[model samples]
Target: MPVEPDCIVVGGGLAGLACARELACRGRSVRLLEAAAASGGRVATDTVDGFRIDRGFQVYLDAYPEGRRQLDLDALKLGRFEPGALVAEGRRLRRVTDPWRRPLAAVRSLVDGTVGLGDALRVARLRGELLGRMEAGGIDPDRPVAADERTTRAALEARGFSTRFIARFFEPFFGGVFLERGLDTAETVFEFTFAMFALGSACLPAGGMAAIPRQLASGLPADVVEVGTPVAAVEPVATVERGAVRLADGQRRACRAVVVATDRRAAERLLPPGSLPATDAGVTRGDKGARMVAFAAERSPIGGPTLLVSADRAGPIDNLTVPSDVVAGYAPAGAALIYASVRPDWAGDDAAAAADVLRQARGWFGSHVEQWRPLATLRIGHALPDESPAARRWRPTGPRLAPGLFICGDHVTSGSINGALVGGHRAAAAVDAELASG
Candidate 1:
């Protein structure tokens, strides 16, 4: 192939893949450049002795409107978690389920005071409202819909949930999702997430989260995506008023269109001279980082693929998940996968952190935790974007920086697979429009 092409897509995560795939489908010659050894970015999985461990605890909510449009859920062969979660309150674990799906669990939840009868009734009303909102494009397709402008903590309080429920449930549960314990994440995000939970199951691809991007890449032409190739900068492509992707190794490939589908830092560097997209909050503030340390047990301790949330919030451990429960092929024969999100404060020293986490795991899973072997300690620096009120509301107007330069990725939209796919589509559409106009 020549050093020049119609378009060049940088970064091999969801957004890059989306841009490349869409451009190709539009009959434009495209080249996808990825710095990593493989695609998927944060949506990656690592295998240890036959057990597939996701980069961190992640799930695919079938309710994401963009995801439903961009992916073939049936082809992914997804495995789902049960409707609700097991909230650990002191020594007892309370079953919290959607009353619409599990009537007995709902009754038990009310009886156990996990949620008061009035609060339960109010939550049901809230669910009905969310359902109606979802019917209008999965609720808040562009911005927050709630009339209240307070934080999640304040909103829950004003809504009349018991103080005990707030401490034991909302704090720890939303903390895992936002990576922030106080629920300071924009109320818009909280409302969107709550609506998603009511709409569908929290699931994973049978192979792993990595399977998501791999599947996306699989549908494209084999030669389109080039992994292990790091792009140093995006410059002019000769005298054609286009792009030249300068690789770290000093090689340059010219193309008519260039999409920098990487992170914010990279986007800033790659954008044409004097082009900036207002420096969005998700770019400046950055998202929270998570440290995950998992343990492999001879037998599953949590019983089935149930997720156990630490209502007490006693230690660095916040939640526990058994991935192999839903996807039997995830673990080696007879071995079960157990993982937890250890607070970043505890991740100062690996050996010390692993020992500390193990000591606390025993309290939750009994003496059996002692027998669970340490699997891996993984830290994702930019796991999810800082979803502040401004960040969630931000979306790209178009993919062009100059006539031929463009940008996309989670940073360009919301910080999720949904956000990335949307970004990709936006870039592709822009490129198609620009080429046709010229």
Candidate 2:
């Protein structure tokens, strides 16, 4: 007899897991299907030779409202990064004071010679402009506005910031966050991210970045999760007999509803012909955002794991983090691990890139880095989620071509952990509503 689940949630990433947890909590017999051996998808951690290496660099931005309301942080053992950023420009290193800290740090940052009077004034002016925009209803938090053309560079330069200030700080900092530092990313994104930086500190989970999804999965009943199960496709039929999902293992599962919470490209493959409507907003299918490599060092770097953005304009390595300081158990005694990313534009020969990274590190840290051993260079495709301001209204609301099939994941909402969680919650609610309507 083919097994039939009341609800089948496809994809075991955070979004899928979140949806499964919600449904299972509601007492529904839900089955979570994961194509991978384990869950966590992009947010995974690996235990290397006596050390922990996160697949990539990811941090919580201000405890997003969706995650704060839905996720159980206690279960995850979340930890925060250091308060302020230690920036490297030329041979000189400086600390960028965090606004949440004392007023003196903010004042010192302004008066400091490192940023120069002009740059300091620009920073203050930009800060005021952002505050004013937020206050005057000039920026709508929900609606995606067309005038949001502020990229990190444009914003900084608009305030008369110097090239040195941008290259050494904003470029690296925003590059680490937005992948393409030169990208004309939406201004709203820059604003929201700046707000997050101001309001919250960079944080990681004790076990690893994977702890986030693991914690969400912990909320689900063990019997409900079915790993290594690939959902072949979802097809919509007639009323009452509506939709069906076929698994790759030659098993057909009947479901009253389905949540396709995998990657957009993967989700599209599972849908029946013409099921998805033609619209500008669909699951993004292309090269994953960028590739990153993670290494475990025997000692901490110059900044002690404070996130560093390489000041080099053409450099391949975008961001750097010392895991030892960000989270306690990231490194064993007397050792540290650092995760570095090679932007998609920066990908090529791994060996050559690694060499370049070491060379660049030597200059940025003011120390020799050639001695550091090379570890796994995790080729993380689809790293960043699509965070364009225009795609805010693309959340899945109606049924997929397959009668009971639905979709979730970063593509559904803007591709952050919070977006994934919110999408999952929305999928669960939609299922509940559908069940009630019937």
Residues 142-191 of candidate 1 have per-residue lDDT tens digits of: 43323345677777887888787777777777777777777767765677
Candidates' C-alpha lDDT: 0.78, 0.70
Worst 10 residues of 1 by lDDT: 140-149
Name the regions of candidate 1 deviating beyond 4 angstroms. Answer: 1-3, 141-150, 236-240, 278-284, 344-348, 390-398
| Residue pairs in collision within model 1 | none
Model 2 residue runs over 4 Å out of place are 1-3, 116-168, 237-240, 277-287, 303-305, 366-370, 389-403
Using lDDT, give the best candidate's number.
Answer: 1
Candidate 2 lDDT tens digits, 1-438? 126667888899988898998888777778888999998888888898766777767887644667788766676676677665666554445777664464676677777765566776666677677667755756433333454555556766776778877776676777667766663445666775665566567788888888888888887877778888888977565534844678898777777788888887787688666655554645343434766666667677754546665665456667677777776888788777777777556746876877777766777764546557777776666676554443333434433334466777776655577767877887888787777677
Clashes of 1: 0
